[model samples]
Target: MTKKFYTVSARYWSTLDSVEIVQDGEKSAKFNASVITAPAEYSFHCQLVGTDDLYPAKLIPNDDEAEKWDVLISSFQIQGFNIENNQFSYASDCTSFFTPGIWMGLVTSIILLWILTYGIHMIMQLTTNSRFDDPKGPALSVPQTE
Candidate 1:
């Protein structure tokens, strides 16, 4: 099998004091403020698959390659709160149900329903016999044919 390469680049405005790479619940590599300031890049290879219908695909590190992606921040503290997770949050790329096409369809259906209702009302009005109408003269009776 061929190897797949993935690149991740991030730029943050927050002051990063230090970064730590933890493996097996222990710190494997630690970089201080000076190292974090320098321009650098890190690459890792992992398996990714479709998460669900909503989500497309995501990186899944196996047991043998999990450690390569386990980079934890040692000094990532904000107001005495520790934010050490290094994984990016998953975001779905799927289209929602209420899209433009669906909206157009809904609007069309509403218009058609309104037109149908109006047509029915007009037909009823046209076919209805008004009891308030005055008779022009005496009613004429048809001659019986035996």
Candidate 2:
């Protein structure tokens, strides 16, 4: 049952990075990936590190078929994380993943707001405050007339 899916136009960051593998512009996989295992040829084992849905699927190969199947299963793993460096370098391709303009717009808006706020803060500091006259005391405190 080959259901056609359009992948997002993205490429892997590198051999070390992870990416979202969506089906037909959605993160939802078409196949029921109910199994997981290591490659049969080698003693290499695979542990499913992540999934979008809580429907977790983790497996280990006990037989040859299960091991061969692991190759197919590996393809389903989305979102690679670097445990060593503690960083996230996201994958590029995903022309199939949903291109919701709203999501993109929201991200853009947040960035713009940050830039604007930062500019305002700098401008206010430059105009109102000096090294000697900077307000170090509480604003609500009444001056004790000595």
Candidate 3:
């Protein structure tokens, strides 16, 4: 079957606030007892651009009550095809502490810090305040002192 070409896009907005969900209702409290967090809100738009089936795109809705926010896809592509549509075929529910960029940045920072530290250390070690005297040759006598 010839795949249909569709375009879909979504924009997300989020804020950090202290909110907690109690048995009665949500209240102002530290999220996970860690820090204040804000709620997330997003909207989606679907449209058809042209006839191309390079890849099929699927957008899944989040079903989590705690994080009452829609799944926002920053960018997705398949077979070099940009996916933008509301074709539900897959779902993912997970939280991540670090992405590839985050990890790369962290590693790069550490490397830079190390390079700076090593450079400073080398400079400090190489510095000399006084010159070494000739030990092999006879020492010169002072005019007044012995």
Q: Find the candidate with the highest lDDT and give its number.
A: 1
Clashes of each: 0, 10, 7
Whole-model lDDT for model 3 versus the true structure?
0.36
User: Among these predicted structures, which one has the highest TM-score?
Assistant: 3
Ranked by TM-score from best down, the candidates are 3, 1, 2
RMSD of each: 13.9, 17.0, 16.2
Ordered by lDDT, highest first, the candidates read 1, 2, 3
**TM-scores across all candidates?**
0.27, 0.22, 0.27
Candidate 1 lDDT, tens digit per residue, 1-146?
11223344343222225434466896354433321221112221122222122322222332343434533222221211222366422222223459789999999999999999999999887754333434896665545661
Give the per-residue lDDT of model 2 (tens digit) for 1-146. 11122355232221221222354674332223333222221122233323333223433333433433322344333323232345323333313344578789989999999999999999887763223433776555435672
After superposition, the stretches of candidate 3 with alpha carbons farther than 4 Å from their true spots are 1-93, 129-146
- lDDT value, residue 45 of candidate 2: 23
lDDT by candidate, in order shown: 0.38, 0.38, 0.36
Q: Worst 10-residue stretch by lDDT in candidate 3?
A: 33-42
Candidate 2 positional error at 112, Å: 0.4
Residue pairs with colliding backbones in model 1 are: none
**Lowest-sum lDDT 10-residue window in model 1:** 35-44
